[model samples]
Target chain A: MHTVTVQVVRPIGDDIQKKAAERSAVLLLGCPQVPVQTSIALYLLSMLRKKGIKGIIAGNPAARRLVEVSDPDHHYVGEVIDIDRCVADLAEKKRDFSLCFAFIHNDAGVSYAATIGSLSGGSLVALIYGEHPEDVAETLTVPCEKIVVKATHNPMPLKNKIDEVLPWVVSNL
Target chain B: MGCLESLKYEILLKNASSKESGDFIRNHYDEVHEVEAGYKILDKHLIGIPPIAVGVEGDYVIFPYTKPCYGTFLVRVAVPEEVERLRKRSK
Candidate 1:
């Protein structure tokens, strides 16, 4: 049974988590639709589902990215260290053919997330960008071999933009 | 040539690669309203010297490269002839 983990690099906020889950779930459906070894796990620092997750690391950059898009709940899931532990936590929750993705748009601290994903043994990378990001897919190859670089060159706000495009992206993914 | 060789050659290669990358983002910032963009190209070739590397030979153009894959250079994607036919149809 082939198992995969989808890790989207973003701040752990209610909106981002929800969007990430939907995006991950959408991509999950594309995985041969096989029941065997099929599981979906999310690597996020959300307060709502904190107890449900294991292998929680402190100071992990992915957590920082999640922090940037924090919601009004004042319940930010901050500080995760020991990257190896985070990977393990994610691995434990892994299911077969899991599709991890991120919703990073207009993020100033995007480079760090890219770096973490590269070093974290990620198989696939879904780069979310607005303007052309100067070959981000190539930059992220050090940690990941196969990459699915998704760029949104549309000038609409991401929330509205996702509505128009997520359906297509989800279907193809 | 001998003196040049003996001297420490720390030439500041004028960070063209990153400059080009920044320019791409700035110019198309509004048009591509997302935070970033992706470039998909095929057949990018490169050759480098032992110590300090240079020259990124890609499918279309060759330019100086400082960093390995992240270096900023023009990414030329060759358009298939069928697409060109479609463009001519509009004219």
Candidate 2:
């Protein structure tokens, strides 16, 4: 039988041990079917790093590949764990994250965000966009901070929204 | 590793327990793949819409089942000879 392993990829930087335990964030991508999700995830990862918060992006293989190929030269995508494994680890208390940013464009995305946010014991921040902002918000059952920008198929519209949410990262709240 | 080796699912619906949900999926899906842990509740991929994420790897299918109360399950399902042959050619 072929075996699948759920290994945690530590964030890159000096003081790796310290950063892993400190203000950490988990960025979850819904699916690679939407190109914009990767863009927004990478953008948020950069912002989080700038604020001294080490972040890890989690998603299925396709979604992870989208981010990986985008920045082959720089470790822009950084570390990732399988979405299934990540949730299991969080539930088991094997890994801890201080904040969670989930890009929600569909029902699966909302479920993912809620699972991670609730397990992380941190702020569950939902990034909502696309044609229907209110509609998507209504689908989310878990309590979380929302970053809504009404843009479909394009990540450009989210720059302002990302800026607005930057303080949350800087404050590390 | 025991949990990962054998597949399980947790039922998320309030009215139904994990045992009830697991029975329903088993009856519907034909076979339960080998997963590491007990089944978790992942009733809905969307609001009121229950869907499962299945992963295809070689001759095996990876099923992601969720229970709202527990977590998610990563189960590996093996395909039969004829089905595997068809899957190979279709790819």
Candidate 3:
């Protein structure tokens, strides 16, 4: 696992000790044209919440709507945030999350994952799914824990990888 | 006003491929940022799924605009606000 050293500047007399407190994890989902990505996101959200982590989902309107519709009861996730704004905030250091899981199925997904991985002061899991996941993974140059699986119709391969990584992530957190 | 809403000036170059547009921007502009397709530019979602070049030229911003069935076009729009925002983010 590659570590990222993020330098956060705080106001004087601020609660510096709170830096070690529980920070949130963001799941950056790509705008999926298929149904499988939504299913995988739902699974990831449930697992993250179960682990007692403040999990937030960020994506475009389409992706957000898909997740929202799937979890109509809002059991897995609450409000779905806008991915572009989230990226901008992360870049400006206006927002901070401890861990990030960017779902990559296209080149744009890779770029988003790399940008978030480089900006966030946390661990990034570049979960590359869909057909030819390796092609998408190759574009991700940032150093982060990557789980590449060629599973577009079925989410088992990626789910297994997530299961293996979640324990380690929670323990470290 | 928002960047897209305040498009006072625009220069569109037709028959331009993604690589050609990227090269044109790189050769002309001093600062260039590679943004992926589907990413938003001033709240406007960029089309396509490949990475495109967004370059800063003085107070203007240059990026690719793709239309389905039609080829990619290089669009140079004067949006100083977006230029400032991009500068801050790039820093």
Q: Candidate 3 regions off by >4 Å?
A: A1-21, B8-24, B27-59, B64-74, B80-91
RMSD (CA, angstroms), candidate 3: 10.2
lDDT (Cα, tens digit) per residue for candidate 1, span A65-98: 3433443353433333333233234434432222
Q: Please give, for residues A1-78, the per-residue lDDT of candidate 2 as tens digits.
A: 999999987666656547544888888777556557888888888887777678897888888777888879766656
TM-score of every model versus the real structure: 0.26, 0.61, 0.71
Steric overlap count per candidate = 24, 21, 0
Ignoring the other chain, what TM-score does chain B have in each prediction?
0.23, 0.30, 0.78
RMSD of each: 18.3, 13.5, 10.2
Q: What is the DockQ of each candidate?
A: 0.03, 0.04, 0.12
Q: Which stretch of 10 consecutive residues in model 1 chain B shows the poorest summed lDDT?
A: B32-41
Candidate 3 chain A, which ten residues in sequence have the lowest lDDT sum? A13-22
Deviation in Å, model 1, residue A118 alpha carbon: 10
Please provide, for model 3 over A1-173, each residue's C-alpha lDDT reduced to its tens digit, 9 standing for 90 to 100: 99999999887646533543355789988757645788888898788776667788898788888899888899988657888778777756688888998887765576567667766788988888877888768767778888888888877888898899889976776
| Of 1 and 2, the candidate ranking higher by lDDT | 2
Which candidate comes out best when scored by lDDT?
3
Q: After superposition, how far is residue B33 of candidate 1 from its true place, in Å?
A: 42
Model 2 chain A weakest lDDT span, ten residues long: A12-21
lDDT of 2 by residue, B19-86 (tens): 34444445555434322231242311211222322334455544444432233443444544423543
Which structure among the candidates has the greatest TM-score? 3
